[model samples]
Target: MSEHIIVRVAGVVEETAHVRTLRLEKLDGAPFTRFRSGAHIDVVGPTGVLRQYSLASSPLESSSITIAVKLEPEGRGGSAAMHEVKVGDHLKIGKPRNLLSIADDADQHLLVAGGIGVTPLLAMAYELYTWGADFELHYFTRSREEMAFAELLSERVEFRDRVHLHVGVPRDQQPEILEGIAGRLTSASHVYTCGPVGFMDQVRAVLAPTVGDDHVHIEHFEAAEIDTSGDSTFTVELDTGESYEVPADKSILAVLEENGIEVFKSCEEGVCGSCVSGLLEGTAEHRDNCLTESDRADQIALCVSRAASDRLVIELY
Candidate 1:
C-alpha cells in the first residue's frame, strides 16, 4: 500500500443537496504538493473504503486541495462516509494523480462535463483562463439543483462568458445540442470529456468524427462493465521470480495480496492507475480505462487487466 498523507478537513461547502466540496489542509501544516489541473487523489473514507476524487481547486493553489463529492446511495459506502465527515476531522489521502489534462497544442479546447464530472473540468477552466487559452466549457445536468459549483463556474471564473450551462434539458434534445456543438469545431479543436459512461460514449461518437481520434480525450470515473465469463486462468511472475496462479474468478491484485504481497491499489475497477506496473514480458488483455494505447505497450494495470498470453512478467516496486 502507498503511504497516505493525513489531512484535516479545513472547510466544507454544500454545493447541492447531495454534493459537497471539501477543503483539505495537511494536518502537519505543510503546504500541499502542487498538481496539474484535473488531478485526483485517493481518499480513504471513515469506513476504510477507498475512493478516487478529482481535485476541483486551482492548480496554482498549493496551500490546500479541494475535492467535490456527490453522495451515491447505491455506491459501496465510500461517499456515505465522506458525507459523514466534518470540519476538523482528519482523513488519509494519496498523492494527486492525473489521467485527464489540458491539451496545449489545440487551436481551441472544448470541455464537456456531465453531472458530478464537472469537478475536474472546473480546475481545467481555471488553468486555461490563466493561460488565456481558447477554450469553452459546456456543463450539462438534469436540473440546476444537481449542478455542483454553479456559482464558481458561472460567476467567479474569469472565462464565465465561455461557460454554457444546459439545465433541465430533456434526453431526446441532447443529441441535437451535441451535434450543434460538434459542427462548430475545426480540425485543430481538441475535446476533453468526463461524465457518465453513456454520456461519454455519445460525446465520443459525435466529436471523434470531427476532431479525429487523436484529438478527442476521455476520462472515466468508472470502468465500463466487462464480461468476465470467458476469463481464463493465467500465471503472473513478479520481479523476484515468485509465481502465482490467478484464477478466472479472482483478479491479479487479489492473488498478489492474498499471498501477502502488498501493492499500491485504489479503485479495483481499473479507473485509477495506482496498481499500474511495468510489463516485462507477455501480452496483456488490457481492460483498464486509465491507460492509452502507447501506455499499453509498456505497462499493465494489475487490478482488472488479465493475461492474453499464458504468462505475464510484471515489475513491482
Candidate 2:
C-alpha cells in the first residue's frame, strides 16, 4: 500500500490550450516524496474521488513532484477538478506506482508519444538524457498549439538532436514514419509507446513485423471500449471456498465491497488496471481498456469486468 500524503499545489502552468502542469510539494515542508520514471500518483479530489496521473518530472527532483493533466470533459471529473484547484490549496494523494518502468541495459530506446500521452515519455526522456543513454523521442500532436512542454523540452541542453515532432494533419504518413523509425529492430533496442489505442495498435502492427512483441511496451490512459449488452448475473468463487452473486446491474467490485470484501482500486472507471485479479476458472467479460488480449486470458479487472460464464473462480491479491 502506498502512503497517502497531504500536498500543497505550489504552481500550475498552462502548457497548452487544454493541458496544464501541476507542481506539488509537501504541505509540511518536508521533502518526503519519492518516485521513479513512469510512476503515477493517485490524487484524492474534493469529492473524495481518487484519479491517477502520471508523474511528468524526473526522479532527480525531490523538492516537489510534477504532473501534467489535460482537461477531458467526457472524463470522470478528475482533470476538471484538478484544473479548478488553486495554487496553495492542499490535496491528498497516494504514493506513486510504476506500471511503466523503463528497462535497464538497453542499447537504445525509442519513445513514441501521441497527444497528451507524452507526459510519461517526458520523464523518461529526461532520465535517459541524464544517463547519457541513446534514445530518441517522437511526439505527435494535433498541431503546434496543442503541443505541451514544447518550449521546455526544446530548451534542454541534452535534447539538442534527440527530439522529433509531427503535426497530425497528414496522418496517412504516420505508418511510414513509424516504420522508418523502427527500421531494422536490434536485440539490444527497446520501444515504448503511450497513446490512443488506435495509435498504439498501429505502432504494434508496423513494428511487430521487425521487433519482437516483448521488445515493445505500451500504457493506456483509457481502456479500449468493450460491449456489455450480453452481461448477466453470475457467481464468483473465492479461494476460501466462498461464493458471491454479482448482478448484471452491479460490478464485481461493488458487490465485494457490499460483503466487506475489500479490494484496492483507483480510477474506478476501468482504465488504471489496478484491481486486476488472477482468473482461476471461468471466462471473463473484459470491459477494461488496458488489458491486452493475452492479459484477458489470464486475469480479470474486477472493477468493470464480470463473469462471462455462470461462475468465475478468482485469486484476490
Candidate 3:
C-alpha cells in the first residue's frame, strides 16, 4: 500500500445537484506539498474502497486541497460514500500523483472538458492564469445547473474572456462546435481534454487532424474496456534474476504479488499509473491510458500492460 495522510474535511461546497467539492486540511496541521495543476489523489472512502479524484483547487494553495466528487448512483459505491461525508470527517488520502500536466513548449494551450471532467482542467486554468500563459478553456455540459465550478470559471478575473461554457448543446450538434474549435487550432497549439470516454473519443477524432496526435493529450478517469481474448502466456524476469510465467488470465502485477514480490499499486485498471515499472528489456504492448508514447519506450504499467515479446525484463524500484 502507498503512504497516506490523514485529513479532515474543512469545508464543502455544493457545486451542483450531484457534485460536491470537499476542501481537506491535514490532521497534523502541516501544509500540503504544492501539486501539479492536473494531479489527482487516491481517496479511501468510509466504505474502505479507494477511488482517485482530481485536484480542482489551485496548485499554489497549500493550506487545503480540494476535490470535486460527482455522485454516481448506478455505479460503484465510492462516490456515494463520498457524497455522504460531511465537514470534520477524517479520511485517508494518498499523496498527489500527476499523469496530466500543462505542456511547457506549447505556444498556446486549448483545454476542453466534459461534465465532471472539468476538475483537472479547472486547476490547469488557474495555473495558466497565474503564469499569464496563453490558453483557453471550453467546458461543455448538458445544462448550466450541472456544470461544476461555474462561478469560478465565469466570475473570476483570472478566467475572464478565456473560459467558454457551452450549455445545452445537443449531442449531434457537438461535432459542429468541436469542428469550430478545431479550426482555431494553430500548428503550435496543444490540446488537452478530459471527459467521458465517448466524449473524449469524439474530441480526439475531431481535433487530432488539427493538432496532430503528438500534440493532443487526454486524461481518463477510467480505463476503456479492453478485450483480452487472444492473450498468450509470457515470461517476466525481474532484475534479481527470478523469472515468472504470466498467464493470459492473470496480470503481471497479480503474478508478482502471488509470488511474494512486493510492488506498489493502486487503481489496477491502469488509469493511475501507480504500477508503472522500468522495462529493462523486451517490447511491451502498451495498454494503459496514463502513459504517453515517449513513456512507453522504456516503461510499462505492470497492472494492465502485457509483454509483446516472449520474455520481458523489469526493474522494480
RMSD of each: 1.8, 2.0, 1.5
* Candidate 3: residue pairs that collide: none
Candidate 2 residue-wise lDDT, 51-161, digit = tens: 788888878888888988889899778778888888999999888877677788678888899898999888888899888898999999999999999888789775658
Give each model's whole-structure lDDT: 0.89, 0.83, 0.91
Where is model 2 more than 4 Å wrong at Cα?
1-3, 292-297
- What's the C-alpha lDDT at position 269 in model 2? 67
| Model 1 lDDT tens row, 1-317 | 38788899999999999999999999877888779898999999899998899999999888899999889999998998999899999999998899989888898989999899988998898899899998899999999889888888767755479999999887667778889998889889999998898888888888889998778778889777889999999999998899999999999999999999988898988998889999999999999999878888989999999999999999985
Candidate 1 accuracy as lDDT: 0.89
Ranking by lDDT: 3, 1, 2
TM-score of each: 0.94, 0.92, 0.95
What is the alpha-carbon lDDT of model 3 when measured against the actual structure?
A: 0.91
Per-residue CA lDDT of model 3 for 1-317, tens digit only, reads 48998899999999999999999999877999999999999999999989899999999999999999999888679999999999999999999989889988888999999999989998999999899899999889999889888888778887768988899987678889989988788778888899998888888888888888888889999787888998999999998899999999999999999999999898899899899999999999988988888889989999999988999999986
Clashes of each: 0, 2, 0
Candidates 1 and 2: which is better by TM-score?
Answer: 1
Give the lDDT of residue 41 in candidate 3: 95
- What shift in Å separates residue 118 of candidate 2 from its native position after superposition? 0.3
Error of 3 at 2 (Å): 1.7
Q: What is the lDDT of residue 174 in candidate 1?
A: 77
Between prediction 1 and prediction 3, the one with superior lDDT is 3
